[model samples]
Target chain A: MFGTGQFQLYNPVRVIYGKGELKRSAEIFGVSNVLVICDPYVSSNEYFKEVMTGFNSVFIYNKIIPNPPCELIDEIIESVYEHSKGAPKFEGVIGIGGGSTLDTAKAVSSLLVSEGKLADYVEGKKKFEKRLPLMLIPTTSGTGSEVTNVGVYTLNDIKKPMTSPTFWADIALVDPVLTYSMPKRVAATTGLDALTHAIESYWATSTQPYTEGLALRSAKMIFESYEASLNGEEWAKDEMAIAATIAGIAFSQTRTTAAHAISFPITSFYNVEHGLACALTLPTLIHWTYKFISEKMDDFVRYVGFKDVEELAKRIEHMMEYSGFSLKLHDYGVKEDELEKIAKVSVEANIINLTPGNPKYEDVLEILKTIY
Target chain B: MFGTGQFQLYNPVRVIYGKGELKRSAEIFGVSNVLVICDPYVSSNEYFKEVMTGFNSVFIYNKIIPNPPCELIDEIIESVYEHSKGAPKFEGVIGIGGGSTLDTAKAVSSLLVSEGKLADYVEGKKKFEKRLPLMLIPTTSGTGSEVTNVGVYTLNDIKKPMTSPTFWADIALVDPVLTYSMPKRVAATTGLDALTHAIESYWATSTQPYTEGLALRSAKMIFESYEASLNGEEWAKDEMAIAATIAGIAFSQTRTTAAHAISFPITSFYNVEHGLACALTLPTLIHWTYKFISEKMDDFVRYVGFKDVEELAKRIEHMMEYSGFSLKLHDYGVKEDELEKIAKVSVEANIINLTPGNPKYEDVLEILKTIY
Candidate 1:
């Protein structure tokens, strides 16, 4: 009689959360030779050499860029082959940085072992059956790319998100100390991204009890720690670090909804930060999705210590303003005429259908117009 | 600064939850020939054949007894060898029953591939490196054995709980339909077990945010549905089944605390059912542990829809009374003088130290006397 609640929950990522965990990577990876993928900022950090001390041999590839392109990932694999003289000498792959760097690392790890360029796999022409032992460490509190089995790469100037069984890393080491150096603006934006993940996953039609539990706890923690985390409080950064990963795990099970779906074009066209772009639509989406999931959202608001969904939505806008972000699309150079195009693009991402009420193009355009 | 919150969360069990998930067991297991370990009651169940229809060949071993002893598990493995004509032909192992049967199945699956008797492993003489692909299904809403990597066995008439990495199943199929036929007594006891798991895991010193979230969600569901489930309501039973597995996942990470530690001797000496026995000390422990974790307990109580911790304790006692179970040890044939012995045995469990206040023998005796 209760068959409709059918769902599957599976995330095989071993998450090690704490401060000073970066140095334990070699021990957790259990490999002597490794390929390190990172942003240049990560490799230049003081702890970089300390983290690599235990490995017998290491090769650092630090050319990662934001919105990692398929060719960049292919270059990473090619560099590895050129460095190793075509021998599979690296025992594991370790990725350390923001979302794009980690996403690139996922592709590099898989492509190093399997045949083909990153574009082929990103386009769904090839399936990754296996990869080197992989571990991800996020240096930012936002993009929970460390825990999710998803990697979004830019293909032909378009963001393509794909999932593979092999993308599930063997370990996700969330050392909040790594995030301690995040500039205030980076922290603010990424913190918003994590908040969006928690809120969207909580109300997604695809959610079940396991993910709901995670989303509720994560959303509460993000709300508590987001402002303090951006203000450079070590303790708050620590909480934000853990909360973001928990939120990532939540959305990993029941992918994200409208906010993420609409964020693609907003970030692509307006040059808005990925997380800030996701958040621009959040307050509106929260209000929009409320009627469909009012009771569930009320449970969330109450559990997170909010008075109501209206207060919850207002609190999000308050956070953006506090972080010096304008909450209007016009402030980000998005013209009113472009709202329809953005709405069209948003509806194209299939995951938007997982949103409660399954907002169509007209609904999407109405939401965009309301926010604009 | 946040180093103390350091923890790891990893559970590789693929959980498929819904009604009639049993019929999809063959598809989820992804194997043909199978060995099923179940209770005799389960083998005779009307849906048993329907569950096994998709398998190429099946061996049903229905000798599971409560508090599964090491020798009995060894015999199940021996029977499999004899029946298969000395060839390991079964591709996987499926366990469908209550806790004892599932625990036996975990041991059998591990023993089938690794060398040595079950006693050797139970006694920590050997380690399990691998197991046949294993899937577990629960027919009762208590014990939560389906999602945990723990198995309790009787070695010398004493319940010895052990954990193994191999004990985590490849899939946990939670088909609530299987639990629809539970007698009121079984339902009440098992429902209490799930609640105890949720509460104990929440208050365990070893807990982190990930598990605390699950415990809160599961405890709330159990509170909302346990009474209806006891009344043979299908929807409530469905919630209970899902809640129990979620609680299992929570405790799988943190282990249980004082209530469970106190349960072993109570069940062993007085023949009280395991779940009911575990629950016997819960109300007292809640009050005892409150002072140490008052704020956290308050959070849990509030989230579970109770006014306060005292009210939560009373609610549990009320549930016991409603279920027709006496809350006193004397009614269960436990002697007044025996309270000290039970205290000693309870404190001896290493897990008792995980309790909030880390109660010692004297405190335990005081708790027992209070409950008495």
Candidate 2:
């Protein structure tokens, strides 16, 4: 609880959560002609159709790709323009899927109002001046993108991203019922994604009391519920959904660190699920970062209900094993030579800046080598 | 943890916490022409002078009276319009002081943008639209008004009246140094105000998972630190300040209930400090509410580190005794005849709707009788 401390935590989205909150989306969105964005899987779900019954004027864009490619966003913006009669104006934007679709919705809404290419707005290059009313409904419980002021998108053949205080969702509808339909593998990967978010945000260089409190609670929830949720236990699934969303909000504010940074390259190159990719590096990163901030690690371990840092790291490894995710980078088809390229790209990633204890490039390489 | 079903929680105001965060106010505010609405005490503090140093164009409105009056807010708005030559249009509004000043700042900013009287926009009649960019810096660490979407002001000859969510501050700066200057009595009463907020919000009808988590943390912090902070202990003071603000944010989302409703008459009639007045009825309300929601009370008791509900009630009694606050209605010069009138007023207050375990008028009367 004590350290060389100063931090800021702020989340400004109104969240409505429960079993059937999706029913209220139309009312919540008001009279706006909404641009409804989702993944192909989500767009075809029975639950999605049920939720969309009353929303007659919604324009569906189900082409959102993972990592939210910049071109996909441009396509959505063009669709919005054509559908809205060349005005490119939507009364509101509704994203109803996992992080990718939600991130795409945010980027499209921001781009719809701003006067520039998507790359011009990456991470503090320019502040977003205007955005349509953006509402997010996170069906997967990972990527708290619904309530965070961040939208992570791949740009210029790189996983570079941008964050602006202005990029927040106006309303976030998190219905646990939406999460109940997820496959076991989807549940596990997303749950691990949320866990990584909570753990990394708690230890990020910019962690604040507000975020720390949230991240701790989220970690505790995930530690207790992630496995149960994957096993299709109802109570645990409900808790996991809540925890994932909360952790998303937490990391969205503080930003993820080395594990998330290291994860991007792995996910992009190896086609690993984003959550699994992040989870793979998490245990090693935690062990390494623990050496620099041992006391904070102790707090984190205790907060997450582990007896010690070693126990926590072991639990993370066990979770990855349980998920059947490949433990070694080589198993994901990474060549021995690509490690250096990843290290170079990762060293420049935003997560490198967010990583607390400031691990050097050499330290990063060593961790990657061990995983390899 | 299991009984109370589903709820939503979201607050999207970035909180910057530490010593010297006040100096960064200008950077967060992003404008030079700032109107600083503060109380006389806060206006005179050296720390406030340090905060003011960052901005060249600053207007000071130091007439914030206890339980701020609506007319006073009108005066401040008129002054802002008169002073700034209508140029920058008050790029930012800064509130520095206790809840009254903070509330005044909220009201002023909200009113500046809206097209009607302040009272017309108190939750029901009209939705508050158009508020200038607002920042709040609380000195007392009580009221937690800095981070909340609430602004309490005296309205229609009533005390403890509040405006709606449109009053949410864009930036809530919680600098421990600002709170270090509060007088012991002020610290005690305001800290209790925060404690009441946490307790009441936990039991609020609208209490969601998000607010509940924050409320529980806030209650734990207040119970552990309020008394020590009252005695002018430095570390405890800091914790108490942070706790109070957190509680404010918690309760601001989920408004206050029976105890807060009961306290208004006491403050209006006897001029008791808002926090102490609210504290007087808390134990009685908690004890009564426990009968309806024993499981929830048990959770609260455990979270607050009490052995049971009895111990929790006793601890609150001990806090009042230690802080030298009068617990009896008689001490505040109320007659036996006033009890019925007070109960009538309490029922009339819309806050009765916020009471979680809805006590009947007789139940309310019984709680009042115990305090009396």
Candidate 3:
């Protein structure tokens, strides 16, 4: 029941959430040649194809890579332009996959109407003039990219993820049916990612009462349901899916902080799954910063159904181990030689400022070393 | 801690909440000549006048009456049309006062652009095509009319609160400073009204996860702050104000049930204040329907910081007596001869169908008898 002095919070997207909601996509997006952007893995699923049968003039752009690359975005834009024959086209862009695919869709939608390159819209200098009617359908329950105003893109040469506020999706369809198909590992990873988003947003310096309520609720849901979801329980899976979406909305209002800042570089450099990378750093980050943000940490731990902060970190570690996720960077093929570059790259990344406690360069190096 | 089935919940209204937010109205409303709607009682307040000074070309329409009569609405509309000269029309309608004034503003705004009378929009058959941009500023921490989509008006010799799915204000400016001038009775009555809205909405047949979360939080706030607010504690006043606004949004989505339905007749016939009537019937209504909606009742008691249902009811009774508000109809000058007419009118109200527990005619009579 914390008070937010004064703030403006609004997400104007109409969310249609249900098992068969995907079938009504055409009704929601009327009389337009649709560009459906999806992960190749998800686009290949038979169920996704079955849902696509209801729509007309649909173009499937399924080349979205995990930690989406700019080249793939260029390819998508060129394909849309080539297919449309110079007419003001693509009535809508429907993204169907994990956060990466959704990010790609957001980027394409944002870049379609703007005159500049994708880099111009990265991290606050968002000059997005117009966005094609956008709809995001998340496959995994984590990374609530569907309802967020952020899109994380990988710089091919630098190997770092860049984010911007201009990347808000017009519609975020969170259907639990999409999550049931995810393998246990994917669920575990994405679930952890959602948890990290909630945790970071809850403790972020810029957080308000509105965002904190959603973040706290989301963290609680993830902790309560993550184990059962990983154990293949149907009810828990549904809850996790909803929790992830809620977390996305929460973090969307207040972008992720310390853990996310550290995790991004690890993912870019080591190719660890985004959620797992964040999860690995979260326990360590919380342990280090607990003294600075102790009250908030205590609230988070209790909210997530833990006795204390230590137990909460242990619970996260236990879940990661049970889900077959690697906690140490070494397990993910990070050599001793790569540590310095990884640390330096992380410091240079723009997310470093999001760390409220202002961890020094040595602090960042120590956290990376502990995880390594 | 509760699981909401797949649902999307986000309110996009820019909420400026605090002590001095009212003074920022000119900035929020931009350069529009503001059309301020308020109860005649509030128009005379020095604080109201001070706040109104910030707006340019301010037009004060203080004809709003209790239960918001349709004749008053017609007069306001005529005034707006005649004064605006068909150019530089009201950029927005700012509602400043209790639920009546706020509800009147909602109704007027909805009708400003439409081609028909107010009655045409009754019961979802809205023919009011266009609406002036609208903002609601509530002076009481009850009714929650500022953040809700329903408006109650006494029309055709009957009091009914009609709801429209599309009727929502662009901004709901909730400032606790405005509530400081409320008398102890006003505070107690309105606070009870807010509590009733929360409790009834939580037990509503259409209650979903989003509404439950908000209702639970609002109920807790009311329980903790209502007495303190009545005692003239500034901090409690702010919290209760926010709680009422949140509860309003919660119940607005899932309309009120038995208590609200039954309370309307008492206000209409006996001339009881809306909040006082709502408070008088709440305890009896809860006791009567507890068996039917026991789960919700238990939840309500716990959330409202009561040890049990009986305790919650006793607390309400104590508060009513302390505030000098009458709990029995006889205290309010309702003679024995008028009971049958009040009962008949209460039974005839269309809202009887919305009672979640679906009380029988005998049950309604029994509830009235208990209050009597």
Candidate 4:
């Protein structure tokens, strides 16, 4: 009478975690020829040098911008084809930056073997089958891009999501050293994003036996380590790195629900950083979702050492504030009057279906108003 | 901060778990010309017929005996070669029975491509490199063999263990239906076996971030459901199946520690069933290990809803009694005089080195004497 569901969990990524994982990864992965995709900022970092040491020939594509555009992916694909001529075709693609770089690595790898424009796949018009062996090293703990299956990019000014079984990474080599030099603000913001990802996945309709424990443990780790991690504590940074990757694996198995859905429009229109935008609604949403998930809420609260749902929500709100996230929507360019439209966009986003109770648009409006 | 240890987590098995997972997995794995290994008992069962329909050609080798002997593996390898003469080499090895049957699958697959006797690998005298695609479907919920990397066999009267990265299964199609036919006693024994695997792995020295949560979660699932599962509850049977496999994955990554070490000789030298041997000393050992691990003990005891160690230990003892497992060594024809030798063999087993706090031989002897 037990396993009463139809769900599939396919996480093939080999995660090698420890203090010097990045340096040790090259030998473990054993690649002779590779393409290294990086954000402009990450390619200039010292850890990026260590990331490329054992490769025989390393082709660098370090121009990925946030919400990576189609033109850049096409350009990178052409460059990869030209560079691999006569050489052993690139054995793997190593994405060694933040979300954009990793998404580009996945998108570019899919484009290399499939027949279609990038937009067609992201827009869900075409299906892509081929994937390169991928080794993802996240420079930021926030995006969890290393382990997640989805490849998010901007298509005609809208962020379009694309993923296939092929987009799954073969290896996720997380090194805290990569995140050690992060600016305090970036560390705090991204750490909060990882925390929200864990919490939202815990509440998602698709949450199951496997994702449940990972999400709870991840949330607990981030709660205990995020502040210290932001303060550049080495141990906390290491914990956060693992926590973020685990959060990514959790949410990837069960895609994000309403928190991410509602945050999208705010990030799109208000120019708020994605992490901060997510943080703005997360605490109140937790309070609202508490009624629908009292059992899980109780377990998580006790496991994470919070007194109650209100206590948990207050702590998360405090975490956002300490992480330099703007709690009020008005702090960003959004007017108070725009709350209704934001709530409408969240309902239309269709992610609320992934929430357990399928929270109504009025509930979304109420949550927005409370946060505002 | 965080991770101060050196560890790796690599589990690539695609586990399709549910009531209909066995049927679903056939289409997903998409194989033909398979060698289906089974216990002679399982081959004669109705489920066995259903297991063979999707394949183009099925080769049956149903001679797996308990504590699978090295000679049996050699015989199977020869028969596999003879049966597939001039035909396609068996593309996949589908193991569908108890622990011995699945272990035989791994041993036969390992021997097919590597030029050596099976005992050589078990004795650590040879390393095999090639792997056959393997699909493991467990008929019994006890062994957790479907997901574990190691193959255990009898070598010169000792239960010798052999494992390689290549020994891992490509797919674990866990169907609770296969286990619904288990005799009540078999259910009790295998469920306890899974519980012990979970507990020992939770405390192994090699245990790291990924395995820790899985072990704890598996342990909790067993504790909550093993009794109901033994009482012929269908849902509990399904949960136990998943829990057992998860526990296998946990211990396979970190290896089992002192409890398993102690239990091995007891099982090998005595005629006791492996699970009963493990259950005989488990509760007292928990009482013993509690002194060495206050923080972890507190977490586990509270997480499982016990008020304290005393309560936890008592509940475990009650569980053993209820599961029809003999708690005293004397009841199984073991004299009190044998405790010292048993403890000596346990320490000499060298697996105690993997236990945190390094449990002493004297401590093991004391635990054995107390249980006696």
What's the CA error at residue B201 for candidate 1, in Å?
Answer: 1.1
Ranking by TM-score: 1, 4, 3, 2
User: What are the per-residue Cα lDDT tens digits for candidate 1 across B1-372?
Assistant: 122488999999999997887888898889999999998888998978867978999999997989988889888888889998896799999999999989988999999998989889988999999999999989999888988999999998878889999999999999999999888999999999999999998889999888888998889899888888898888899999999999999999999999988998998888899899999999999999999999888778767778999999999999999999999999999989899999998988999999998899999999999989
Worst lDDT run of 10 residues, candidate 2 chain B, spans B1-10
Q: Between 1 and 4, whose TM-score is larger?
A: 1
Tell me how far the alpha carbon of residue A199 in candidate 3 is from the true structure, in angstroms, after superposition: 3.6
Worst 10 residues of 4 chain B by lDDT: B1-10
DockQ-derived CAPRI band for the predicted complex in model 4: medium
Q: TM-score of every model? A: 0.98, 0.86, 0.87, 0.95
3 versus 4: better DockQ goes to: 4
TM-score of 4: 0.95
Q: A32-137 in candidate 4: lDDT tens per residue?
A: 8888888778988877777777888888888888888887798888777777673338878888888888888888777877776888887788888887778888
In the range A177-291, model 3's lDDT, one tens digit per residue, is: 7788899889988999999988887777766554665676667678778888888887788788777877776677677777776776777677778789888888888788888
Each model's Cα RMSD: 1.4, 4.0, 3.9, 2.3
* lDDT by residue (tens digit), candidate 4, B110-174: 77878878988888888988867888889888787878788888888777877788777888888
> Would you give me the overall lDDT of model 3?
0.75
Angstrom error at residue B302, model 2: 6.0
